[model samples]
Target: MRVAVFSFPGWGHLRPLLPLVRELLDRGHEVSVVVAERFAAAAADTGARVLTYPSRFPAPVPEVRTAEDLAQVVVAYYEEAFAALPAAWAAFADDPPDLVVEDALSTAASGLVADRAGCPVVRAFPGFAGNDEVPLNGSEPEPGSPDLDAEHPAIAAFVRGLPDRLARLGVGEDAVARVRARPPRANLVFVPAAFQPRVECFDGSFAFVGPQPPADPPPTGWSPPADGSPVVLVSLGTSSNDNPGFFLACGEAFAGTGWRVVMTTAGHLDGATAAAMPPEVELHAWLDHHAVLPHAAVVVCQAGAGSLMDAFGHGVPVVVVPQQPDARVMARHVAALGLGRCLEGPVSGADVRDAVLAVAADAGVAAAVAALRSAIGSAGGAARAADVVERVAAATPTDGGSQSAWR
Candidate 1:
């Protein structure tokens, strides 16, 4: 089988899909990955054919606070999708992909590719999958906060205009309708069903495969401190992680605490500032989580779905300080699951220290972590994701023809 995979530029968006790509390749299938120029090397390292497109926006995506901001974000996401279409088409021009694996948010790009190839698609969700029973992040917005379901006129206008734009590109009505349909042909959620909210609502169409670890772990040249103190890994992921205060607070929190702190500042801190950090804290611009998680005893992070998965996969607990609404929901889930602690609103160095210490010492949290790790093991990682992809591909006709699964 020939498979084509698509994901956004960020590490969080691209990382989860690579392991699945590697699995497909190992099974004697051809795989091609379409990603932004910044991510091309990582995608290529998986041994899949890499197709590059220019990124549409600057790094550290601006926070979305207003309806207009949300609309702008939608526009930028599609812009990147459209930019990616040509490279994707060219890479599979002679013989189109039999299956297309998509990052859940890359709907527009996936729809266009599937429309052209007339193939089945599997949407990969890095986090929770929502239904009528819950929102996408798997939790309800706080009272008076903007509900994800609420329709803002700006966002509505963009959505309303999509059909016509798709039409101009020769995407037929049937194809558009199928792409807009709910409960897609197959949804490969990269989270265990045990961790999903209201798990009863999702049917067989959803395969809750937990996060896929790196097929080939990257080298980071990092190791635990020789003093043998427990290690804490702190990161806020690639985007929306420009909170200097949070990073500084973390530095202060672990200072002189007999804990080895490894942090990924993502260049949010200047050289002088980073150099001034406590002797026990080591800061980097970026480091693969796989290289750090095995040695980590605890993680202090921003509650990103990918980050949480990395911690849980290793049975490491977390102290989540959410910086966005979606993250807030995941934070609650962490606390509810007894897997970690959630720190809400503004926090001080002392608050972070207290939470990290408290979560680390909690016997109940350790048990919950063990249970979730077992669940992740059973949910299947890359191998299971490959099975779902092959199953969805098999559902297509043998004559290399299309079906309603991806009209």
Candidate 2:
């Protein structure tokens, strides 16, 4: 099988899909990855053939500072992405993919590619939010906050009509209808299923995929935390890592606690600030967080699904400080699952210490972490996901002059 994987530009979106790409390829299928141009080589490192696409926006769109900003950037991104379909179609058709895997926000192409090339498109949601219903993130505006008006109404409507759009590109209207009719695109949720009880709202078309196969190391070198004390990994996440004050606050929180801190400032933070750490804390542009999270005793992090999922996959407890729209939802899930505590907004050192201490000292919290880990193992999510994808592919027979294939 020739499989094509697509994620928007963000690290949060790309990281989860990485392991599955490897899984498919390891199972003896040809895989191609479509990602932002900057992330092309990163995907290539995993041994999949890489294809590049122009992102709707240029790099550095700024941090996910507020709900409004979240609404604005995401809305604009999908709007521009929808408009770019013609070019994207041309690029993919030049070398057609047998199967297309898509990240949460990459909906239009899912219907388009499957329609145009007669392939199966697997919709993967990176966050805990499984679909349009039981929203992992905010589907509707918060009660008190200014309503997040979907500014891109034109594209929003266009996305709703995606099946018809794909039909024009040769995906039969009924076939395209079947694809869109499945809520949230036959999604596979990468987070723990116990933490997510309401996924049924995605209409049984979706199934939990568990975490992507365990992440692997990049063929590059970056120093791991060398501090002597039990290591604590602190990261605000890929897009929200720009807060200098947050890092300074974390420094204060861990002071004298004897916990050597490893903070991945994600290149947005200044090295000088990290250099000034009070003897124990080590700060750097980025770390192989997936590599480090397993070794750390506790993770003090943004409620990025990528960051927390990596921590949970290793049975590590979390101290969540959510900074974005999705982070808030993720934090709630973390607390609900008993793995750790959630802290929103500008987190203080004292709060960080308290959450970390709570996770460390309380046997109950440790049990919660263990329980989550056990639940995932019981579910067999990765295998289940692979089965779902293959089953879906098999359901739609192709008569384009070739025998059917399976993994």
Best by lDDT: 1
Candidate 2: lDDT of 129? 53
- List model 2 lDDT by residue over 1-407, tens digit each: 77777776788778777777877777787887877777888899889987776666634453555656667666667654454355567767777777777777776665567666767667787766544466547344456554445645654675677667655665456654565654332567676567675654545555666675344655446445555457788888777888888888778777888887888887876667766567767777867776676568899887877777678777789999877665676687688868899887666778888888778787888898887777666655556666666666556444322222221
Using TM-score as the measure, the top candidate is: 1
lDDT score, candidate 1, position 368: 98
Q: lDDT of each structure?
A: 0.79, 0.70
For candidate 1, the TM-score is 0.88
Q: After superposition, how far is residue 119 of candidate 2 from its true place, in Å?
A: 3.2
Q: Model 2 Cα displacement at 377 (Å)?
A: 3.3
Summarize candidate 1's per-residue lDDT along 1-407 as a digit string, tens digits.
Answer: 99888887778778888889989999999998989998989999999998888877546565677656666666666566666766665666677888888887777666667877878778888889876676787876566543343366656776787677666655566765666763346778888988999988776677888887433456668777877898889888777568877888788778889988888977889876787789888888888778888878899888888899889988899999887666888888999999989999878878988888998899999999989988887888888989878877877356323222321
Please list the residue runs of candidate 1 whose C-alpha ends up more than 4 Å from where it truly belongs after superposition: 57-61, 78-81, 90-93, 146-169, 213-219, 396-407
